[model samples]
Target: MAGTLQFDLVSPERRLASVVASEVQIPGADGDLTAMEGHAPTITTLRPGVLKVVSTEGAKSYVVTGGFAEISATSVSVLAERAVPVEELNATLMDQLIADASEATAVAVDKDAADKAMADLVAMRAAAGF
Candidate 1:
């Protein structure tokens, strides 16, 4: 098998990452999917969770809110709703965000709106590991 695959991670704001990695684990719709060089071409929807990339240097993790991943034989591209490096995550900020989302959801008159807010808050908390 080949040693590495080219990887790109993009968000609505900008391209968050571009690198070559030996392996990557993504939060797929069904579950976590691991990819490596020479993998078959496919596309998968991603959930809000941690994406782990492994290289000769080491493993790095990123928090992805939502997106789709395109996997080719030699490349993988992820277009995310929101993408952030794990190193940049702040527990305090996440806590505040969760509280705000919760408060808004609690007073929301529309059930669907409240559900979406709750889901968003849960996803953010999950991605942040809080």
Candidate 2:
């Protein structure tokens, strides 16, 4: 743990990942950023994209819709609106997500909200390589 940092990824439903990692790549709202053990303290909003975690166990990836991340010298914590392990995602799931997003967009109360939802889904699809 000498060169590693504690990283936690939490969705509204549960904690997705909590482990010591050498590096974490987050899809920040403004852009993507990587955090290491000695990184400076910072906070950022997330966009729809993939999050990469690198540890002794090797690398794992998750797809996040939106969230906020708090970074410190010793840890990085993410509170995600929606997060799913990339390995668990499949074409069927992606199609379902897209359909759901389309429905939500169609029934959205406002244009801005609909746009955001659609954009998030689109990003998710692209990230999933579909």
Give the top-scoring candidate (TM-score).
2
Which residue pairs collide in model 1, if any? none
C-alpha lDDT values of all predictions: 0.77, 0.84
Q: Write the per-residue lDDT of candidate 2 for residues 1-130, one digit (tens) a residue.
A: 5689999999988889999999999988767899998899999987666889999889999877667999999999999878889888988877776676577567656667567656766777776687
After superposing candidate 1, which stretches have Cα over 4 Å from the reference? 95-130
Number of clashes recorded per candidate: 0, 0
Question: What count of clashes does model 2 give?
Answer: 0
The runs of at least 3 residues in candidate 2 whose Cα sits more than 4 Å from the true structure, single-residue gaps closed, are 96-130
Model 1, TM vs. native: 0.72
The candidate maximizing lDDT is 2
lDDT per residue for candidate 1 within 5-31, as digits (tens), equals 998999998887788899989987656
